[model samples]
Target: MKHERGLLIVLSGPSGVGKGTVRKALFECKDTTLQYSISMTTRSPREGEVNGVDYFFTTKEDFKQRIAENKFLEWAEYVGNYYGTPIEYVEKTLQEGKDILLEIEVQGALQVKKAFPEGIFIFLAPPSLKELQNRIETRGTETEDLIRNRMNAAKEELDMMDAYDYVVENDKVDSACDRVNAIITSEHLKRERVSNYYKRMLEAE
Candidate 1:
């Protein structure tokens, strides 16, 4: 059998666009063995979040220190908090012949693609900006100022959607998950990959 190719699945979306839910569903696929790239954040976990799993909770000072040390793959600031993807985990997983899923913002996704040129980028967009605004407002925990700030930021991020490899519309949870999962599964069976495998096997025979 030929060696399998690894995938770098970089996912991006505006705030409250259902990225997490879509990613969660992808993990449930039978043959899907992609690992999630746990990001480091200075923001505190709300509730029931495990340290080092859900996120690598850290101090602002420590986060800055990581930046100084050049440890982060990609980092970005939002709503007065800093978030970064850990480069080591990404490298290790791909080295092991496993795919990785990175959930980050659009700007950070651009940074990641520059670092790993072969990575696949998928952008999940809401049905509409109005729906995105409703999702934020319906959350009910944020102050008016915070909600307004995020909505404005989402508008800016939406403009960057054209840079992605695949654009998925998150109008419904199940439908959106299916679209994202299909994109990944379809990539695994590309003609060049299959042709390369046959070439290797015939040479060995």
Candidate 2:
């Protein structure tokens, strides 16, 4: 039997939009099957973080070398650190008929869209700009200047929302997860996907 290539689901949003929190919740569900694509970063790992699991931490020199070699499907430098998705791992997993989920920043996601236009792009949005600002302020890890800068950058990111295939507001994590799962399910059941399988089967017969 021929294995069908799996879906590439990209989830992105502005900074401080709880992308990590939402992704963690989504994967914890008993029915979730999407394989999380661990990204590579040039930043220092936080306490208790595991290499090749939370993120594939690497040196800036090595990361730049990989970028020069076109090893990444998409990459972007942010806050003096580089983050990217390794193309080889994603391609191999999809070839094995396993769905891959990429939770990344807006800039990285846009790069992925250009390289993999067929991939499903989901924009995770906050309920409102005020609420987004509140979320950032609530973090308390960033300085006032940094928060202001992030808010400005977020406005720009929100402008790019039209580029995504679907928009799910993060009013509540559970609701957002439900919408994302539903979108993936519908994509799998789309006529375009199923019809290709049926065509190949008939040709084989």
In terms of lDDT, the best-performing candidate is 2
Q: Could you say which candidate leads in TM-score? A: 1
Instruction: Give the clash count for each candidate.
Output: 0, 0
> What is candidate 2's lDDT per residue for 1-205, written digit by digit as tens?
2338989999999988888888999889998879999999998886677899889999999999999999999999876789999999999999999899999989999999998998999999999999999999987677898898889989999999999999999999989999999999999888888887788889999
TM-scores of all candidate predictions against the true structure = 0.93, 0.92
Per-residue alpha-carbon lDDT of candidate 1 for residues 17-81, written as tens digits (9 for 90 to 100): 97877877777778777899998999888567788777899999999999999999999988899
Task: Compute the lDDT of residue 100 as modeled in candidate 2.
Answer: 96
